[model samples]
Target: MPKKKKITPNPSGSQLHAQRISELMLEKKALDIKIIDVRNITTLTDFFVICTSESEPQSRAITDHVNLTMKTEGHASWHTEGYQYLDWVLVDFVNIVVHIFSKTAREYYEFERLWADGTITEVQDEV
Candidate 1:
């Protein structure tokens, strides 16, 4: 099969943006943060920022912080979903997508398992 075309408008910038989002997630005390690099695996997006919160409120807070922080960086989310339920909220930028999920929701979904082929980086801060 022919190699698939990658959608990398700015790989470096997208990586940096994903890092920033991870930082924002950390700021909100989101646990088990993982940034999955799916560039070589798929053309869906450059990175997937996944993090888990303790509860619904925590999940919403993480999403809000990421959304606002990204906006301040002059990068608005192209779209967002699952805000109504707060179990798993997705903040989508064109190059990076942030997943804010509650502990239960995250465990139930097991998103990382599905993307095991991708390069996964777990983010840890002393905060």
Candidate 2:
């Protein structure tokens, strides 16, 4: 039997959407921003955009901005959750899932570590 071929992350594939989501999150001052390229590992989504929110209000703002901006840009989220508590608001866009978490929640969950197999990239906060 032939050996299985490893799938490598493609920079040009579905990354535009993920980067746009990351920018949207940054618009609301999301902290510790990261983009996990999970295409090589899972079919769940091409990418996972994760960030830490300084407060509940900030978390809500980030979620709202991402959803609204994406909608206006001609891409709407398939589903959303965690808005009531704002501990971890998720906006799913079929191609990507944006996770806005509180500091405690981010530390507790360790999403990046969990997706260690994927190519995790840290997005620099705009000055």
Candidate 3:
């Protein structure tokens, strides 16, 4: 019988980014935060940090804070979308992409279900 190799989870750069984004989401009182590791399944991006906000203003605020915080750490967003409406603001950081959505928008899109192939890490809300 062949022995199976045990996989040890090592925290990579993208994982660290995901953790930071998760913390930021909690700090901003964003709900239902999840960090999806898509490295093994896709080459497009490494991680997806998704969160939900109660209101449009809160969604915008979360996105703004994430952008500002990450920028201070020498990482800038590659591209941003949906900031004007604040329904679903996507802040792309190349390796890590953040999706801040309103409750309705989040339920509509269902990113968690969409990216089910990736390993999911649920970030507990501290606020």
Candidate 4:
């Protein structure tokens, strides 16, 4: 029998923020949700929350929820983009950048493949 290793919580708090974002995405029914820890790869952000939406409207809804939730926590985006078309809406917090994409847009962008250097964590949908 193999002994199971004890899991420890991350002390930096970024992990919590990442997880919260993932959960929120799940709530909004985002597909293929994932978290990428990019601390080592770049100074741009600590983490990236990437997910796909069924359509442009869903992408906007997901972005809105994330923006509103983060605002309630006193954190706001340094800059946001792609809302006009909503094919890919990017909500950029300094520490966390969220990429919410429509299905076709997500397939074209392939952000996961681009950021392969980062530690990728796939988030499962909540029951």
- Candidate 1 stretches with Cα past 4 Å from truth are 1-11
- lDDT for position 55 in model 4: 82
Model 2 vs. true fold: TM: 0.88
| Model 2 regions lying over 4 Å from their true place | 1-13
- Models, CA RMSD each: 6.7, 5.5, 3.6, 4.4
lDDT, candidates in the order shown: 0.91, 0.90, 0.90, 0.89
- TM-score-better candidate, 2 vs 3: 3
Query: What ranking emerges by lDDT with the best candidate at the front?
Result: 1, 3, 2, 4
Candidate 3 lDDT, 23-107, residue by residue in tens: 9888889999999999999998999999999998788789889999988998889999999999989999999989998889899
lDDT of 4 at 42: 97
What's the distance in Å from true for residue 104, model 2? 0.5
Residue 125 lDDT (model 3): 66
Clashes of each: 0, 0, 0, 0
Please state the error at residue 3 of candidate 2 in Å. 33
State the local distance difference test value for candidate 1: 0.91
Write out the backbone clash pairs for model 4. Answer: none
